[model samples]
Target chain A: MKRNPWRDIRLHGTVLVLVVIAELIGTIKIPITQDVAITIMPLIYTIILGLAFYLIKPIKWIHRKQARIAEGAMMLFIGVLIAKLAVSSGQSIGLIFEMGPALILQELGHLATILVLPIALLLGFKKEAIGMTNSIGREPNVAVVVDKYGFNSPESRGVFAIFIIGTVIGTIFISFLVTFSLSFLPLHPYAFAMASGVGSASMNAAAIGPTLAAFPGLETQIEAFAGFSNLLSFCVGIYIVIFVALPLTEKIYNWLEPKIGRESIMPKKEDEEDA
Target chain B: MPDLIDGSENVSVHGIMNWIFLLAIFSIITVIGNYLGYHHPMESSIVGMAILSLITLAGVWLERYLPFNISSILYISVIGIILAFPGMPTSEFVLHYVSQIELLSIVTVFLAYVGIGMGKSWDEFKALGWRAVVITVLVIAATYYGAAIVAHIVLVLTGVPAA
Candidate 1:
């Protein structure tokens, strides 16, 4: 059956309703300590509520097809968000140029993903460690893995697992992490804003939302820094993943697999059997 | 691999039409959200969203027609920067209206779609078991903090005061 585009009306309508409700509720701050509070934004609420409505079996409000449509629409909608942020970058181009080194160098922090490999190997992840720890395993990263190794390869499976996990909870996780870090970290808000551009649009937005709320007076600068940093990440990220991250991951996997690697919990692949 | 990797789509007439349709829906919802959440005037919000959508479409056009392979977002960002850069003819007007639409308001609408889309993947999410979940948390923390620490150091080195 040919998919009718109008069927998406249901998904769009639901999101429209959810947005209105979320905006009305506004930002909520829950006190976690004397000096720290977790700031929950309207975006966070809509995501949770939209997920609940979709998952509720009784109503069948969203079909699998509609959900899939929503996913495609999401890719396009992110462009609008990028355009919005890019304009900020343009308006504040002078400030961005002044902070150019910080903006450029902070992306190296993505290399910190390797910090998790030894743990993954110790937990007996095998070749899967390369895919999971090489990067945050967003769509492009997954594609690189799948292209190098076939889709059925262990590395592909590793990348897919991270991609799925990222799609599901990455925004929430990043937001909370940003909020928590803001509470105690002695960093400047601009630094935090630059760090918040983690390559993924939704995740970047999630990270920036909290940082903006925490430092209300610095909104323009924060937006400009985060937006430019994110754009930089998006443009340069794939090359880094393929050249630097993937090769580095393989080397780490080789060196550490013998030192602390445990027996594999996953079944052995055919390639491994021959070896 | 696929279009997702190269960032190129079919760009057929039907595809372009669908994009326009979806963008219209997004703009309407965003205008409503901007009004309710940030109290931006609805008229300005509408104009703001229209400008954004036009920029997005132009970026898409460039992505499809440009000889080099590049993501649409890159084009969109460059176009936005040029249009809004200081002393540009469009800078004042573009910034005036676009700024009216709050970043968080656009985010709220975008993530709602993300959330609804996520429902289909719940079973796959659950099947990943505890180990993947653990690694996901650890990796996120490591990347975020690692980058923040590096940026903080750079900023401090450059004579920017810490908060």
Candidate 2:
């Protein structure tokens, strides 16, 4: 299909429209505790954009390659905001140190995903399913899995499955989970803010949204912490997956393959061959 | 140096024009959003948008020139931070105005694009079958609680009271 340039313009321009609408809703105060009411803006604009994207179905014009470029460019400005937050954060060096244990713990939590491998194995998932569920289902995981296991490997299938899921629902899940935890947990909001970063920008934003809304005063510190944590995860996460996460899953798979007695856990021929 | 200039000369006018157009639209959205949301004066909002545009442009170009696979977002973020750091000459204006820039709007738009991208890949996602659903659940469980557990322990150790 020949792409329409005007539609391309609107597609890219949608963000601008949503920004205006979000400005109109402004912010709302939520009572989290006595003497502390966190004011969070209702995400009306996001909900509206989501509804329009699905119902209106404006999924034409911009080619995939072009969209990727546009997304990358949009993210660049977001990054600038993050950097600004970081600079603001640096002024309060005490908060940085005060938040250290929380940051490290969260990174460890991100790394703790290795636990999923054994669970998958014990659940009778084929050897191939181990790699996919064990690491984050992001782009880099896709690359690493394809590189080591080959594109057609059972491992690749597992990775692809999780990647789709993560792409579609991961941010929403993270956002909700963090918000729910905040109401019940006794931790400082800063801890949740750092934990919110978790590598993916969208996921970071989603998780941080409630936290920022809850403590609008700390937006800069929270954004900066999340950005920093995300950078750390991105920089170190790939290596962890390649050297530790993937390899460890492989070892666990080998050990559990015997216990399952080579039962055909794979449902399809392609998965069997890949295995 | 001569080779670099030759390469720069080969840059297409269409690409640069597209970039400029995108930047203009972004600036317009930002200025209007700032004026409406924060109730800032229109003049200040325009000034703020101009500064943001320049910084963003520099960031886009820097990403192209810089080596390695670092994200453009990180590059732009560093540039914004350095230029607007607390004692810098432009710190006051940049900090005061940039802070007014609405983040959730960009986030919402970004996610919407992501959704569209996912919709494009719908067929591929469907092909993964049921196991994909199971894997997704497990991955979410591990990640969400994994981070939460760590935070819980650390906070408790630090003597922070639970809510």
The lDDT leader among the candidates is 1
Provide the fnat value for model 2, as a fraction from 0 to 1: 0.33
Error of 1 at B88 (Å): 1.9
Docking quality level of the chain pair in candidate 1? acceptable
Provide the TM-score of chain B versus the true chain B for each model in turn: 0.77, 0.61
DockQ (C-alpha) of model 1? 0.37
User: Residue B15, candidate 2: how far off, in angstroms?
Assistant: 4.0
CA lDDT, candidate 2, residue A238? 53
Task: Provide the lowest-lDDT 10-residue window in model 1 chain B.
Answer: B4-13
Cα miss at A105, model 1 (Å)?
2.8
Reference-based TM-score, model 1:
0.68
TM-score of every model versus the real structure: 0.68, 0.53
Runs of candidate 1 exceeding 4 Å displacement: A1-3, A100-104, A117-275, B1-14, B148-163
Name the candidate that leads on TM-score: 1
TM-score of chain A of each: 0.64, 0.59
